[model samples]
Target: MRVLVCDDEPLARDRMRRMLERIPATLCVGEAENGQELLERVPSVYPDIILLDIRMPGMDGLQAASRLSESDSPPAIIFCTAYDEHAIAAFKVNAVDYLLKPVRQEDLEKALSKAGRVNKAQMLAVRRETGVAQPEQANAKEREYISVRSRKGIDLIAVADVRYFLADQKYVTVRHSQGETLLDETLKELETEFGDRFLRVHRNALVALSYIEALEHKGNQFYLRIQGVEERLAVSRRHASSVKKLLQSL
Candidate 1:
């Protein structure tokens, strides 16, 4: 089985690499210093399991694992970190294992033995636990995940995937990169919750400003073209001013 190690510190990575040599039938495929680098390597290396550190410079291990779980086939995640506070929360997410540093040879072997593929549900749980802001924490962060029902049970989509939310009577259709999802959330609630990320293009629609490609006009009616979405959403006259202002800011 192939194993990938990700940690910011060189010594931690080296130690994990040396321990991998002791595990039977295991190959140390690669090592990454940060989450972004780890993501870039996964497509090429296709490691069966990843030894991910919880604390890092930019993206934390939890956030990184959340993104990885969205893939068609995600690698088994074993969070190896110095922090003990995150251990209980880790198991809630069904992580293969959580090894405290310095990770022992026995611990590494045990973690790999029970390692299994993690899904997005567990990743969402992890995201919720990690995203909580303490009273002392400066950044009072909102959840990065939006839970929606799918054929594969509850699919937790990264907010960045959402192109827009259009309210249709009782339901709100979330148009994302992959496809649209009918959710129970109200447009007003969504607008209030994600006001910073999304913009009201119409009374019935809240479009993600990050995905807004350009605003177009068709026979005196305005429409919005999104980056990854095919359908162009109609921009109401009431919101055209705000949309135009947003384009100017962008």
Candidate 2:
């Protein structure tokens, strides 16, 4: 398999090249110092996979990945970053995997294997023979996942598994199928990103539209009954009417 390494540091690029040499049946097609250089080299190298760095001097990996996603056929991306915070953003661009810096050989091998499988899926898709989903479909909110820091490193919780996001003071708790986790982002930012899938039932809460089983009123207060949960979230009067209308439409 042909691979391209893109990083701002020469030492980092050299290190990645050495790692690729150790992996059998893999060839390092080219190396780039930054996103701009990477774009310039891709047409010539035609790499099957890209080892991309998140932070760069010009046109970072995320921006470059976005541009790549718009192409007729794009290479599978594996983000190699020092920070875990960008994991969510990485997957948003359809990254095959997120590997932290000082990457392990076993992890690289696994990610490459996944990328190879995805490449085959894309090929089948081109022939109109398979319904396998491609990475570009991740642009939609329904295909997106939320990344959170955990004791075991980063955990990607599917947006579909999420029930609601309730904010209290500084932290926003994400309630999902696997329980709850605190997300670093704000409620307003989440509302903007996932407005179509999640409804603002109150100033401090955003509930998944698919999970809303019923909206009830008791003692002049509106409450939302969420599926699979015993706790009822209080809906403020300001958003009660809009919530009701949305429920009717659903």
Candidate 3:
């Protein structure tokens, strides 16, 4: 499997590279210092798997994984981070697996094994939980669309055309190429259902990584611009590093 290893620390990157050499199906296709480098190399390398770190200098791994999910096809994402607090969020993002820092060879092997079973849709669900059932279901006919409950009735939206989802108190606004629709679900509920395709940019907002145009930083604050949208979304201070890293990767 072609693999991309991303981390800010040189020693950490080297250690991951060395450990990967022991795996038979794995190949170190590239190494990135931050999320930005990963994004730039993704189109050309087309790695099968990515070993991503949660923290970095510019862009962090979580943001990078979010951006990668926007591509026509995305690789399996395995978060390799030091913090346990991110585990819940990582699973919400549909990461194939989460590996704590100082990744063990056995754990890496297990992750790779999991990656091998995953397909593109599964990878997409892992990124945003857009309703894909499993890694193998990516190729199944039943997995291509999502049903949204609205005042009109049950509407099915093709998963690919969805741009983003906005949370407004108890309601969720589903934004797509055609327009927007309101659903009676919380952001947290949507996170459970479509976690593969949506990422929480803020506490209330879950956005489609593909629709993100750019990220701007002013002092310690950060905001995201979405394609065809005039509004700039604010990212929390806690998620700032991850957002920047994701933009760099894009």
What C-alpha lDDT do the candidate models reach, one value each?
0.73, 0.79, 0.72
Model 3 ranges off by over 4 Å: 120-250
Cα-lDDT of candidate 3 = 0.72
Misplaced by over 4 Å in model 1 are 116-250
lDDT of candidate model 1 versus the reference = 0.73
Candidate 1 per-residue lDDT over residues 1-250, each given as its tens digit: 4588999999988988988877654667789998888988876554668899988988788878888877544778899998999987766655688888888888888778777224223333332343311122223465687998878899887776688999999999988768878999898778767665566778898877545656788998999877667778998887686566444322
Mind giving the per-residue lDDT tens digits that candidate 2 earns over 195-249?
6556678889988755666678999999998766889999998877765644432
Instruction: List the candidates' TM-scores in order.
Output: 0.46, 0.51, 0.48
Q: Highest lDDT, which number? A: 2
Candidate 1: C-alpha RMSD after superposition:
14.8
- Ranking of predictions according to TM-score: 2, 3, 1
Error of 2 at 122 (Å): 1.4
Q: Residues 1-250, candidate 3: write the lDDT tens digits.
A: 5688999999999999999888753568788999999888776554678899988888888888887787744787999989988888777666899999878999999998888668434454443433222222222233456678766878888755566778887777877778887767677765665555455777777776545655777777788876657778888876676555443432
